[model samples]
Target: MSAVIALRAPLDEDLTAFVQSLRSLGVAHRVAEQGNEQVLWVPDEQVAAQVRELYARAPQGDPGLQPAHTSAQRARPGFLAQAKHSPLTLLVLALTLLVALLTWGGDNYDAGRWLSFVDFHIDGQYIYFGSFAQVIDSGQWWRLLTPMLLHFGLLHLAMNSLWYWELGRRIEARQGALMLLLLTLWFGLAANVAQYVYGGPALFGGLSGVLYGLLGHCWLFQWLAPNAAYRLPRGVLVSMLIWLLICMTGVFELLQFGAIANAAHVGGLIAGCLTGLLGGLLARRLQRR
Candidate 1:
């Protein structure tokens, strides 16, 4: 895996000379544009040190090398690059959006009935059996995961999707797609079960649980692996924690923000923290060995 060491948009001639120097030194490297900046990535930290040394020794206007393509002329990596870097995150985002679209506007859709993990009744008659019971009775195991795909409204979908993208991508980038997938499933199951246990047999669904899980995972992983890139800004952590506290206080319902899944959030955070703690400890032990 490569680590980005420098982020600078060098002049055409300078970039050409730099690339030539790297090639001559047999250092593997790549250039990628992130937002408005061009990033220079080297596969090894040792190679990055050599690159820094070369830059320091070379003259500013060395006329030995020909001009290369400008940074603007280089093609910018798009969605495919993003997906490649964070496939699990993008896949989850796509599935969530598709489910949101399919179940839009209508509250009585069969999709929701099949996805939610709770049983609900009307007038003393069972309208739909609980997902957990159905899985045991009918072998429809997908119900455990489908709950995380359901969203109630546009605002709900937008907020959850935004957080998922922001947090999920970080985990996927730093950890791996497999880790992200496992964490999502684990968090989804724990959160859905917690919500069901706490408020039983009702309509509730969103990725807020998974979001909290990602939040906790990143929060703790950064503490354990300071050199790892899985860091969250302090402001983001504080704001989210404050919001969680506010939601738990039943303020959202009072202000007409609708019902808050306080149990799911708490359960997800706990599960994520545990997972992160274990992962961090394991990572540290491995590094020591």
Candidate 2:
């Protein structure tokens, strides 16, 4: 089972006290030692967030931290309630769905061009792509990040949205919506630019790159902190990396998987790992202090 680090106390005394309070509150947790600190791990992201909140408000193990009854612990929220906690994640999903509908899951070329990495127009029996100079002259810079909003088919949309929902909300809840947006844009831009260089002026759209980015971030972050919010299942990490390698082997195109964005996947993963390293170091520093 994947567990999250809910508390990282430098002193064993603090860990013991907090563990006692958490136990009284009936929160399922485990304690592990990481270098000079004692890290408390919990089952899920919501529980971790709640534990952090209560601990922040009353670090001395007050009644607030240890509620009146064990049942006072918040039950997991349904989809709507969870969406409220991560509005930006929900909003991005909504936008992607809207784009999918507008472009008929990427078959509508005219509509797709508006959001592709470069401007284009459909002519009789052929599509014309704009030159980089033309795109630059038009001052339509948003194109770089918008391709991620496009989806090529129902299955593609569903798969990407499901993964985004799974990975995006975790980070949003743990960090915040603003951080999530920044990271999304960072991943999206990197993915788009890499695909642009790889395939040049082609219509490629999907959340696959961003999905890899999130997976990469979570993989590295979990290694650094062992936080539940960032913990990815072991099989999941290996499976994705294996899939990426398979895609790079040109088997997908041969099998008519509609031209895999291999470069985008690699680029986003690299960006996410770097991002994860930076974020992990900062978080580790905060925990030590």
Candidate 3:
């Protein structure tokens, strides 16, 4: 439970240098404490204790070194683990469950009438609009946001909500809840608008587009915010790219998958990727200044 604290030298607060120095101390594990601080845990033996004392004798101003008893802290799940607990995920799952209940409860469900009724159509176009656009032009601009609340079927609701539940946890953990909420709305609305422009007035309703947007956001974040440690790893990016390619192969259409709007997928992805790049650059610039 003895954690090694960083003793930064005067004018030598480089995080990389500090970490390298810690590595030289033969510490096997490390964790960030805050900006410019870290805690390194080492076996508490006489030799290691001597090494710690010697390292603490740097000529720079006295930076305190304390043995933090982490037995209690390490015994329980950390913040990230607790934040991502299944109950939080269940909240999103429950929301989708409610939507599915309503969709299935309707009498007209099998007739395809109920499904078509909720779908968004661009006026005079073959492409589907995001439910947002239809709601907006129909003088229910408020519905632009609420239409995302609607789900057509159990599978549809389950897929979207699962994505929201899983990815939403990671996004919230990295960017905080407020940023995740804003990004959800931004990607959802922007992609829907993009679909209307590109798909030429087709009624579309689904969260798949927003899922694609989140995928793009994840990728772009890796590129733009590499050092932020919040982006997806390379393996995830490769797998997602493969998934997108497969989706675009038209197999779903050939199989008669009804109302899967790939247009919204493409549109939302493009918008979110661009926005993620912008956000990363902005964050980097702010860090520099």
Worst 10 residues of 1 by lDDT: 59-68
In model 2, pairs of residues that clash are: 4-227, 4-228, 5-227, 5-228
Model 1 Cα lDDT, one tens digit per residue, 1-289: 6585743552222354566556555678886544334468887777777677766777332334423654333323466776688878989999998888777722646656667665444454446545456566877677667788999888889999999988898788767889889999999988888988898766778999888988888888667744334656689999998999989999879999789899999989998999889887776665455
User: Positional deviation of 206 in candidate 2, in angstroms?
Assistant: 1.2
For residues 93-114, write the lDDT of model 2, one tens digit per residue.
Answer: 9999999999998888878888
Local error of candidate 3 at residue 166 (angstroms): 2.7
After the best TM-score superposition of candidate 1, give how far the Cα of residue 15 lies from its true spot, in angstroms.
18
Model 3 has an lDDT value of 0.56
Q: How far is candidate 3 from the true structure (C-alpha RMSD, Å)?
A: 9.1
Residue pairs with backbone atoms closer than 3 Å in model 3 (clashes)? 120-203, 121-203, 127-202, 128-202, 128-203, 128-204, 129-202
Each model's total of backbone clashes:
0, 4, 7
Measured on C-alpha atoms, candidate 1 has an lDDT of: 0.75
The TM-scores, one per candidate, come to 0.72, 0.76, 0.61
Error of 1 at 260 (Å): 0.8
Q: Please give the distance, in angstroms, between residue 227's alpha carbon in candidate 1 and its true position after superposition.
A: 3.5
